[model samples]
Target: MAGIDNIMAAIPGGSTRRFYGTAHWDGARWWAKLGDGPNNLLDAWWQDPVQPLQGGKIAVDITKDEYGQAASFVIGGYTDQPRPSSGTVQEIIPAGVATQIVIMGEDAVAYTTDRFIGEYSPGDPVYLTWDAAKPTVIGKIGASAPPPTPDAPVLVPTNPPGSETLIATASDTYWAPGGWGSYSTSRNGGEDIYTGTWYGNTVTGAWFYGAQRPALQGKTISRIRFRLPARIRGAGNYNDIAIVHFYAHTSGARPGGDVARVTGPHDIPVPPGFAGGDVDLPLSFAPALVAGGGISIAGNPYTGFNSRLKDANSGRLIIDWSS
Candidate 1:
């Protein structure tokens, strides 16, 4: 038989009891053997709304069962749900933030132990949320930021009236792939590509490059390449990075029928530190925009090397930037 370690904190007047454990209170039927006795008076059975109360608090109802060992309320929010008040903050759970109650005084003749304190205003209401990852407390209450006033107008982008066309400019400077750019290069090493903005005089066009494999379904242009430098680490390391050429059709659209071939302008160098030393490379072929629904970008397989690494403080990165 399993050992028993439960000690009940009965209400002054009512028979409702609360049990404590190393982790939490299990139901009396299941929490019979807690091992450790009630260590503090704050440990008691209570049922409070899971939502965070702004200025008010609610009462907790505690009572004893027929056989009366000790029992506590359990719900999704009690262990799973997040506190409603976690607005813009990542909404992390606070340590030692248990849902148990502290018994201040019990009303002996009332037949109901005053489970909790704090008054609830008529205005405040409870909210609901979910946590499939784990069990949580229910009815976590939180406050939403008040609407901003006109003087404190919330900033939002506004489209100009009747403006249909957009224009963008191409910079000369080389930019790292997937990195932001506005820089100009000296000899056009196939490094910088950007979305052209539409001006009254000029209609800026988008840049596209790389192998246009129409037969390969789901094959997409990785990005609008202003430039794609070769793998210039030394001799034989360069593979002639692709460049942007001219568009087949005039209007910028998807699944573009026109394709551009390799246009000259090759260089070989390093972009600082690879296996050591500078790495410089040049663009091989010109790039062109793709249109229609047939193109798609491919994803890379993730390595768990980052998973095994821990933060300096020894914390694990469960949810990554991409995750």
Candidate 2:
């Protein structure tokens, strides 16, 4: 097993179930063995809506068979999906002192966690966040990076507000080459254009670029805007504009339910050369997000515009909402 299952789960039959190990292609479909166990409480079953990528870790769900031993386990989600959380504040930076944190190899800002608690003195769990990356901090936290159950992690708000902003920099990007397990990368490294099948000869398809919006229970989004930095489009994809789609994100940040996408300065028009200045992509969609429900975004890889949008945390997926 590449990684052991941290969460425990229960099956109807009786035996405890597991859902981690090296995910592999079994000729027919992809699967990872539930680590040897007597576990029952379904550990970390974040309703992932997609398949595992090669070399990526896997989460499993028992299907059809009785609850005890389960007839079969199906790949439920890619572990390491949520933006890695840096447990506890290593040190507290005042309101706007500008800070940085390294998560899963990406440099995340310390201010991203929603309304840091007044009593948060360092050692406490600072991993709570509305989304993964970006500058500003908002309100409420969704799921833990890993280990925590599907129930969204909650923090006592310092002075709770009716509004919160989920920045794009606070997002997580995962990649998979072959058909094994998926791994996460900091949004620090700009995400790629949605190419669906980024693999060439051996590997086939699987690249999810997205951010997990915080569980803003009882509130609704007031405005949703994507700030895209200057970018250059190529002839490969007919220089078409990138279109982003939103979906219900499983707890682990997996591309669940429907396919998704990502990238920086994603939808601005560019000439053959580097487009100057940042531009906001205008989207016309209902801000009908369920109060406090976890949501996600995915890139439309069919466009084949695999160019890199290499801006720092400046380019973001800004979501503003009120209760």
Candidate 3:
């Protein structure tokens, strides 16, 4: 009992457009009849007959128009029995059953059922039967499609953390008389000699440098020490009292205007040259180290005595700080 599936007819150029019908094989030939509708009542018979042998089958593909009306049909080949409904195994469960599948007639919709009869992987073509209440997977059809290719990985860069540090050092000896803007009569000793003059109440002169000078730029003077060789003019008199004062200036030169008095106006008693030792003065309140422009040092001799700062291996200003 072989037969063609359901068929529908289309009327060209007519409002009574389409109608459903059926076709069957009557042992020796194919026969068809349209439904009893207006302009659709007709019987059709295959012009070329098909005579099936004792145990044989046939396959066919029918073409349809845009209106889903039969336009033409082709007999593909012959087989043993009617072809069973088949699908591709979309997903398989642990129980060796296909839970999701795509069928010939319902390819767009994934049909869910416990139908698979054997262990199967996804994408394996399958033969199935849905005649019973639940669908059943009767057998495998063919090999599955290949798995999709994967993409490559990407690379990125990472940076390390940052930190802070403090740099400190002792600077070289910076001289005075050379950086000083104004001065009185002074002599230069190649190594060791007494140069500046002495007067009553005014022993030595003032020496200063201008503001924003390059040597002191972006630096603070943390400690300042001066090496001075001193001696009294008369051999017998040791009462040559002199006060050495260090000052940081803002504007004008020496003894006037905005002045930051640093180091000391401390007294130093000048002994006879044979007994005179080094004068070590540690300066304080050196605000000019950060704020003002330059610094200076002057001498104040007490009333009746005359003192002088000898120049030889002395009068070197040493500064230490962190920039």
Against the true structure, what is each candidate's TM-score? Answer: 0.16, 0.28, 0.27
The better candidate by TM-score, 1 or 2, is: 2
Residues 204-278 of candidate 1: C-alpha lDDT, one tens digit per residue: 122222333243223222212222222222211111111222222222221222222223223222221112221
Q: Considering every candidate listed, which one attains the maximal TM-score?
A: 2
lDDT of 3 by residue, 1-323 (tens): 11223333322321222233444444665433333333432333221334323222233323343444443322222433344477666665544544544444234445666545766677767777753223577777774667655664554434222221111111111124342222222323121221123342123232233343344444555565544444434312222223335444343243333244544454443322224344444445244533432333444332111122233333344555544
lDDT measured at residue 40 in model 2 versus the true structure, 0 to 100 = 27
Instruction: Identify the candidate with maximal lDDT.
Output: 3
Tens-place lDDT digits, model 2, residues 1-323: 22232232233332334445544555676545444443322322232334455445555543322322223343344434354444445554453452432112123433433344334444344344332132222212343345656787777875344544443322333444421123212224434333223333111112222443455544555655544333224312322233434343323233432223222222423322224343333323213223222333344433222222354433344555454
Per-residue lDDT of 313 in model 3: 31
Runs of candidate 1 with Cα error greater than 4 angstroms are 1-128, 136-144, 158-290, 293-323
CA-only RMSD, every prediction: 24.9, 22.1, 46.6
The global Cα lDDT (0 to 1) of model 3 is 0.38
Score residue 108 of candidate 3 by CA lDDT: 47
Q: Poorest 10 consecutive residues of model 1 by lDDT?
A: 300-309
Overall lDDT per candidate, in order of appearance: 0.24, 0.36, 0.38
